[model samples]
Target: MAEPVLAAELRQEAPIPLDLGFALHPGEVTALFGASGAGKTTVLRCLAGLYRPRTGRIRCGGETWFDSDADLWLPSHRRRIGLVFQDYALFPHMTAEANVAAALGHLPRAQRAARARALLALVHLQDFASRRPAELSGGQRQRVAVARALAREPEVLLLDEPFSALDRAVRVALYAEIEALRARLACPIVLVTHDFEEVARLADRVLVLEDGRIIAEGDVGAISARADLPIIAAAAEAGSVLDATLVETLAARRLSVLDTAAGRLVAPVIDAAPGARLRVRIPARDVILADRAPEGLSVHNALAGTVAAVEPRAGGLADLLVAVGAARLRAQVTEDAVSRLGLAPGRPVVALVKSVAVTRPGA
Candidate 1:
């Protein structure tokens, strides 16, 4: 684990002064996650010298950027912090190369152009370096911003919703570019996002915040299991995003049992058993409601439960969230069917699912 290159204690006032503290080390990506006003941006702004806390200290590597009590405060420019914004924020009138060159203004013109070219090439936009922001696509403009931010080669990188404006495919490709950049750079990255899926894809660790306070922090795997995580993401994607441990291998029958929220679910042929955690996705659409426990059904994972909530899904589909054991399993059924089955907030129901469908993630 690389030591943090960035550190801070946050405060926005009142009951939760956001007395939060977190650090980032070389090559580590720390995701700042929370609701709209959880102070995620405030934390980033403070680090960027845009927002100053009444009481807090910030350090990058061995240099102390700010010490409120000690009266040490470095102005924004002196901190050497690179920023990537939600909007690409490239100069529309200038060519990509010029925009990138501007970021290296402190350097001589020739050296600045050389660095800009290198940064563009790093983002695979070398050929488009001369094009103005207006001539480029959304993704292209974003790459220019990234190149510009890197042109300065700061000690730390702070990105506030960098992928927000782009389409999914574009955002994903850009995020991959960032991950590659993360591998090559030594600077600690503080990425603020409201999307857990993005966090799962990009962050090494997550800082879960609410109401300008740090409520929880952990790896993506642990936080995905939280009941609320799924609601942010769709029920289909939420469940539990696990790396899946392989505990046992049943060679004779070519099957394995996975210890999951559905309890010891027997999975297909695998080299895991008992203690191994298997990656599985229980789609809300795949889960079905039953009135009673059938003796021998086609489905294997059956959970006896009571209807927790019956909510509307798009296109007349309804989500029947049932509380099974210690976890809530979501099933999508027609609203009419729910009405016909007399399924309501407190009605008894069984969640049925096929084990074969619970394959490995992306499998």
Candidate 2:
């Protein structure tokens, strides 16, 4: 694999001790998630040059931004990074366009406004260009902040709980917009968030941190399948992310057939053409176990598999990792059910999943 666009090895002593390292590839979104004081924000600060680490190396696109061993440190302004803070930090007195224009101050003053307008259009806020932060809605203000950050055309984008301040409805809308932005921009994006829903929908890879150290790290499916991570298992949203290709679309029934490693599965219709590949999330809670072949059921997908592992969780619950061919699916069931059904590794089983249970692409 090619070198990551953003690479960092960070260690700090003040405030909270942190020792962590990671690499971020282009066009990928890596989320840092944990409880408050888990050092998520600290990592972002170090990457942005806002906090110099006690010892570490930070590189962006092969450019050395910081190297404690070499006694090198790049100031925030010198490092090319676009940061969107939790609070939409727009200039209160400036219009949406003006706030974006402020970041383009290096350009000719006359050209900044037009460039700002173009960016606003890119973010679907062309009509709100003239409105000030105070006059605009929370979502519109955030769009302005995103535009302003992109005005620098940084090599990396950093988002720190950017949607936490917005209402649920508005946050959902921004989530789609951010995903759209990711498609248009090729830079590596780092997001800091405490919301698991946000992590489920926005993160291409997740890093779970605790006490200033990484407790778990992997793509969504791998992380979700591991029973050893108490942090993930406790969420109750643990599940697999399957990469599949749309093979057929049943327009009348509003369903699509996906070819996956586990087998052919049916799901709710996605707005993608046949042959297009997409990721679908299946929450462990949504899966059903059947020792025998199920019949007279409305569930659209049932894959034959064997029990791979069974883990007991709190509250008399158990998680079963089932291996179907080359793919693994996690199912959360009550401990009583496990005992009644006699489930364990090497046991034959069938996994039933509803068509609608398949999650949307970011999830």
Q: Point to the candidate with the largest lDDT.
A: 2
Candidate number of the best TM-score: 2
In model 1, the Cα lDDT at residue 261 comes to 52
Q: For residues 97-135, could you state the per-residue lDDT of candidate 2 as single tens digits?
A: 889999996789989989999999988999998888899
The residue-level lDDT of candidate 2 at 238 comes to: 74
Clashing pairs in 2: none
Q: After superposition, which runs of candidate 2 have C-alpha atoms over 4 Å from their true positions?
A: 355-358, 361-363
* TM-score of each model, in listed order: 0.70, 0.94
Model 1 lDDT at residue 123: 97
Model 1: runs farther than 4 Å from truth?
Answer: 14-17, 228-236, 244-363
Q: lDDT score, residue 261, model 2?
A: 71
Residue 134, model 1: lDDT of 89
